[model samples]
Target: MVIKEITYGGLSREHLFDRLKGYPIFLNEFAEMLLFSPHFCPSPQQQSLSVAEITVGGLGLQQGGTLEEIRKQARLLGLVECPLEAAFYSRFYFTDQEEVSKKVVNQNPPGALVIYSKPLLADRNFPRGLYLRKIKGDLWLRGYRCSDDYVWSPLDAFLFQVNASSRTLE
Candidate 1:
């Protein structure tokens, strides 16, 4: 699979949101809480990253498991968690929402692209993760909170950071 390289940083949170004006984004309550929380700090310096989009099945968890299991599988497969800023950058750079929506409409599947990063605690200390999905022609930047026992689906797509030197899985 081809890896996508993107540069992130050098912009304030408000500026980043302003840049996403033309693009559609829907933030859920959890997402809003997380974004406004003190924990959602973006990097100050610019950094280039190589990222990969893969499915839970691609991580060798056909039946899926909890987040901990998912992370372990990703590490074993030579994938690393993305930084928190990656969620913002990925949503900003992923301009092909219409195409993704088309595919979801035709395929009739839940097409959400989740950015795998260190889970941040939102209100009430809920662990939140960011995901992007286009529904009814509207793009959504949603946040989800799942328990430790929650089992992810095999078809669930995840975006992860790829080490530049280690492209091939172990």
Candidate 2:
């Protein structure tokens, strides 16, 4: 398979860290900046026209709703409740342990993250964007694409690397 390298539009690895100034930074407001700022030339370069994506946070929609839990509570009270009422509460469930719930935004202060990084996978489905989540007091970064539900990779993977002084192509 022939894959092309993807570059993040702004900042080097070290510089990105500098911008963060450390974890606990609030990044929920810059979703759009992280998405198109650098731009990715469609993973497969031939998937479809374009994919639609909603910026990560902002309304609490990202965290799903409390209807299911509330429904159960109402049902226990023997009160008549509409089944459809809880539909809006649908939460994002992950198929793998690696996936983080949108609830992270709610649980974390300032409510959301705006993180960016290099591409670890150039597969057609891999999205070229940023992700931020706070879990157990430690902040974690993720690279999640639109249309699909999965973190392409972790930001930590790029933390350490040596620069090559020259290319070996003939």
Candidate 3:
């Protein structure tokens, strides 16, 4: 597992966007909607967070599972969901192309790294999750809409909060 200490919530939405404008980022329509929504509010003070990147397979779901199932497994493994702002800051700070390439190369079936957070409702009240991907040398920060029964792929990577009690996995 790759763990990173991320500090977020000090900047406004526009400032964040301006900072990200220089990067190779592509936000889908749903992502934009979610970002600008009233539900998406950053913290008033800067907060430090520890985030871990793991795959569905790593979570012991060889066949993949629904969002609820995945969350259960994560809980069993001592992992907790991240905040919505973690996704934005994660994409903003994860600029090391080589590191991302290595992760992609290690995946049996490469896929986006979806941040495990409280799902935000998008258009039509669809639950949305933030995901990061490196495609054709360009970084993507997109929002994916999934229903309660939607099953995530085993190869899909998830970003979760690393709490103090979380067990360390090799």
Candidate 4:
């Protein structure tokens, strides 16, 4: 389900501009996640945290689990589509587009959905990470960050170069 909130660069109004009661600062990022994976759900923690679980990939990455755990699971599962960068995107939820990936232009032709860990750079109106892409006839992306990092890895920086189309939006 798409989040019913106005957003720019993935940040919704409730997160960047309006501070609603009983909602965590990262809620907006989690809301956008629903747009990517149909099997995922957001579990808010007392308006302080937005945690999720990965159930569709046959992976046991659970809610409240640290970002490293998700990375480890992806590695163990050897999901080719779930690249090492999925972890980086999840860990650094709010890095700039330039910080998203070095090459940036990923599978934009097919349209990709980037998911994020947490809302990093919440103060800068930045976007979160771990957008989704389909390969092997399935959607895959991973990460769960509690804090945002500005440091962009090679694949992550390329996220900026991606030209997302409406295809992935489905």
Q: Relative to the true structure, how large is the alpha-carbon lDDT of every model?
A: 0.74, 0.28, 0.76, 0.31
Give the lowest summed-lDDT range of ten residues in model 4.
154-163
Q: Name the runs in model 2 displaced over 4 angstroms.
A: 1-11, 17-123, 148-170
Candidate 3 lDDT, 62-99, residue by residue in tens: 99998889899988877889999878889976665332
- Model 3, residue 79: what's the lDDT? 82
Q: On residues 94-163, what C-alpha lDDT tens digit does candidate 1 reach at each position? A: 6575435435222213678888888775343564678877777777777776666777888788889986
Cα-based TM-score, every candidate: 0.83, 0.24, 0.84, 0.22
| Candidate of highest lDDT | 3
TM value for model 1: 0.83
Ranking by lDDT: 3, 1, 4, 2
If ranked by TM-score, best first, what sequence of candidates would result? Answer: 3, 1, 2, 4
Model 4 vs truth, CA RMSD: 17.5
TM-score between model 2 and native: 0.24
Candidate 3 ranges with C-alpha deviation above 4 Å: 97-109, 122-127, 165-170
User: Which residue runs of candidate 1 sit more than 4 Å off their true CA positions?
Assistant: 97-109, 122-127, 165-170
Judging by lDDT, tell me the better candidate of 1 and 4: 1
lDDT (Cα, tens digit) per residue for candidate 2, span 5-94: 223223443444344445333333333233233442223121111111112221123433232332232233322221110110110111
